[model samples]
Target: MPQIDPNFVFPVLIGDIGGTNARFAILVDSYAEPKEFPVLLTQDFDTIEDAIQSVVLDHTSILPRSAVIAVAGPVEGDEIPLTNCKWVVRPREMMERFNLSDITVLNDFEAQALAVVSLDDKHLENIGGEAAHPNGKRVVLGPGTGLGVAGLIRSRQTWVPVPGEGGHVDFGPRSQRDCQIFPFIEKIDGRISAEQLLCGRGLQHIYQAVCLADGITPCLNSPAEITDAALDKSNPQAVETLELFVIYLGRFAGDLALFFMAQGGVYLSGGIPQRIIPALRNGSFRAAFEDKAPHQHILKSIPVHVIVHPLAAIAGLSAYARTPARFDIHTDGRRWR
Candidate 1:
């Protein structure tokens, strides 16, 4: 276990790097909140080090002695490659390039999970269910460039984040409409993983599948167009696509809650959920979440919330950097202090 240095310097760098965007922030002091810097497009930079330098050196005057980067992919070995991005993050190279004394890389969802306890009413929009259990397990997930999942367990007073590639699990159809749509999805991708029909690309695929099922020519070109059409009730295919998306999201959340026994709550984060708040508040999401028989009662008791904080992962990474011992990070069959 690594010990927290009593003389450790202030002003740590924190980042939440996804496939599309890389968000950076700095924690100047223990009492001060993280100050966010302008977001950088991942494609603009060829390397993660370049992205970090562009943000840290160009904008801020503060020189950080350490950093904690939350990446939207599995963090393993020495090279952590993002699932949906072209850049590969090599920790040792970054440390040398940035002149950092210490650095930690975490799965994006692991950082999101760490932020669960830090979230308050202002950062959350409740969807359904009773109050969260005081000490029950909490599950955090969302769809952005891809789907991410993690669980938060309360050990003593600290929270332990359990990150996994839960998004890649086989997607199971739950409704008559789902059964019909699966064929269309399988035709395109050969196999239907949960992420295949739940993330940004997944939304587009769902729109295509809906159009095919209705014998209509596919017209929507992007996820944004589909969402816009659905929100305005302009296209029946887009509307149906959003409906199925909400239902599938609910089912997936419920399944994860069951798997983690998340009585604390199920939190929806990422770029997609905040945009589709109205669809989530509708009855379809809750109805599908509680549809599982014999376990419906348990599901009903689990609270569902949408994380509205834009820089939540940065806050999480900041917390972990300040006190690494407070978190239980599962990586390479080891736990860091």
Candidate 2:
């Protein structure tokens, strides 16, 4: 069992590091809410340590005694390499450089999974399905710089987060449109993975694929631009691209639900879901989610919710930092506390 230090000092450093931005916070105490710092763009700093120093250390007078960082990558060995960013973080190096007693690093989605159960109705916008089952298993996933997937299981009184590289799994096309788009995606990369069509870059790729299918010139340069065009109904190709993106997202989410038997709920997080809330609420997403034959009824019963909280990962890291025993995380051989 993991032990929590009752006498741990105040001002514990907490961070949620993603490909696009790095969010930092300082926890004064276990009971008090964390004081969040300004979000720092990941590209501004050459290294993860530099980003931390510039954002957290340069701004605050309170030096943290301990740190808990949620990184968007696989946390395996001492070195945690971000999947989307070039910065490779070394926890022990960070501890020594920052003069911290201990540091715990977690997969970004793992932190999100921990935050799922704690989220209230205010932090969520329901997308589909019936009421969420009270104690059933839950799955949390979303598209950002890359796709992130994690499972939450209620083990007795504690919630355990099961983290994996589910984003890199094979992409299965369910519809005729998906079948047509797969070849274009396959041309870019030999095998079609979930991340290739579900991330920020994935959105752009989808837009390009739509243009290719129509034999038209691809005009949009970025995912934001594509979404803008789609929302404004300025470009038919962009609109179709977004529609396909939603269907793929729904199908992929359903696959995850089936794999995890996520009866509690399917929670969507990250940048894409929140930005495209209108598209998600158009009934197409839910319809695609429940299109599976044998388990259509099962999928319909599982509620879908989009996390609206901006700093959910920070809340989760704080929860773990305060009460380590409440979460059953398999750290491999790593000692978090």
Candidate 3:
């Protein structure tokens, strides 16, 4: 059960646990900077606690009194199973193993949204539009192990991070070319979801779909190969796949901008955006994003930035640890004591 009063004790341990990597940091005090540890691969550890014990506790004598974990899964019940990884976030077990007073869990994108709130200009590259509106609503979405989506809304002085399975929303072909190729794209649970065609595997899916649509033999098996071939324009099929990807991404971002009425801006996180900066900036992305018939004017003012921060989620956890009052995370049944 959650503690009656969720008071975050100092010397807190904060982590951004993803499907592939788990990053941790320690906030010793409000004034001191976060002491970040080495990144750990999820498959290398048997459990989330084991990785923490090996990389963090084993190396440093600085024990934490509390922990705030942002995982790539829904934060529910005592056991929070990661969507893509084998490791599970067991708050009860973590509390007992670390001898911590409290543990607060959050969705991975929720952490990303918090980073959106605290991030500055240097960590972002402008893809389109003007400067962000001060304290306005913002969204952060990206494709990595999967497509992650989250939004930030300001309420009084604190910012609220809204996290959900927005990535799984239905995405259909809008153009004639899309209709010709989208049928070959893979489907999850029978229907095509945004993540189905926008993730690392999604890149492969797109390449394969293009190959099948054009009656060509599929060669690229990995996302890296497809992306590299696309970037270099060494393969015509790969090039077309990348162009389609950019269009799909823009359409989704635009849709979210209109849905959330996000005036602050849309931040593209994850590894994909950083890799395809050139493709994203070639004007096709912005054009597809602004193609909404009646909503072009609204999207014009809404900016889009790609987050270039390598350790954004860890920084977000650090921010929450340092100033928990600034973000409304709503740790109701999530915090275990």
Candidate 4:
């Protein structure tokens, strides 16, 4: 199908699909706000189409003519099975089921990238850093089902989003203590990728590693358990686990900041950051992030912020829908018509 004109892609259905939840919304027109539906659990539905049907068509009198969806995995070919969830996305299938003429699929973090530039102060909380360069490049990465990553750059007047498998990149021990603890952090394919220690399972993985490093038996079984135990200071292992996790998160985020020279800012948006605000603000996360000796000055100049919006991805899609001409998003492979 040929690319659809942005000016005509209205009455769009925008969605942000994650491993645990799927949220839907409708942009009835270019100037109207999105009519958001209730969030649905991914386990409750067998496919994306089912979730849309149950939560959308069944309730709304207004039917959408187009859709812009953001899912938590790479958008390839026609069928997209999410990296952390079981629901697979087929755009052609959706177009036929919904009686649509156009649809565009986006990487979850790519949608987040769009949100970075469009969000107001009410939706963002500054973690640390100097004043942001409004037009400089920006990066958005977070620890969720995986360590999702995406970048945004200004091409004259257009904002172009950069997407890739940045989470799966090689990550290793940098300090003496990191060497001891990282050994037990587990590996995906004989290597310690950033996602291995920066996501939901990453917290638990670090807990087990902390126990083994100190000769203590592992007790916690879930991320929630570790988070609670750490926050309340009830469990020493959990404390170390969460702290180490924050340290590594800061390091990785700092790496990305340098990778893109994200002078605009480094925004954190994922399920975990919002849950552990105290730990992230305790100074350790920022320390590790700014610890890049040679470029510490440069990194310090780049601001850091945590995205506080509960429905950030949805908000990003809404921004694009409202002003599609502002972004230079290519729909060659990800779009269906």
Off by over 4 Å in 1: 1-8, 187-190, 330-337
Please state every model's RMSD to the true fold in angstroms.
Answer: 2.3, 1.9, 1.7, 1.5
lDDT of 4 by residue, 55-165 (tens): 998999988999999999999999999989998898888898889998889999999999998788998888889999989999999898788999999996999999878
Point out the higher-scoring one by TM-score: 2 or 4: 4
TM-score of 4: 0.97
Candidate 1 vs candidate 2, TM-score winner: 2
Local distance difference test, candidate 1: 0.86
- The residue pairs in collision within model 1 are 324-337, 325-337
Give the least accurate 10-residue stretch of model 1, judged by summed lDDT: 328-337
Model 3: number of clashes?
0
Per-candidate TM vs. native?
Answer: 0.94, 0.95, 0.97, 0.97
User: How does residue 179 of candidate 2 score in lDDT?
Assistant: 74
Q: Lowest summed lDDT over 10 consecutive residues: which window, candidate 3?
A: 1-10
Which run of 10 residues does model 4 get worst, by summed lDDT?
A: 3-12
* Candidate 2 to native Cα RMSD, angstroms: 1.9
Off by over 4 Å in 2: 1-9, 186-189
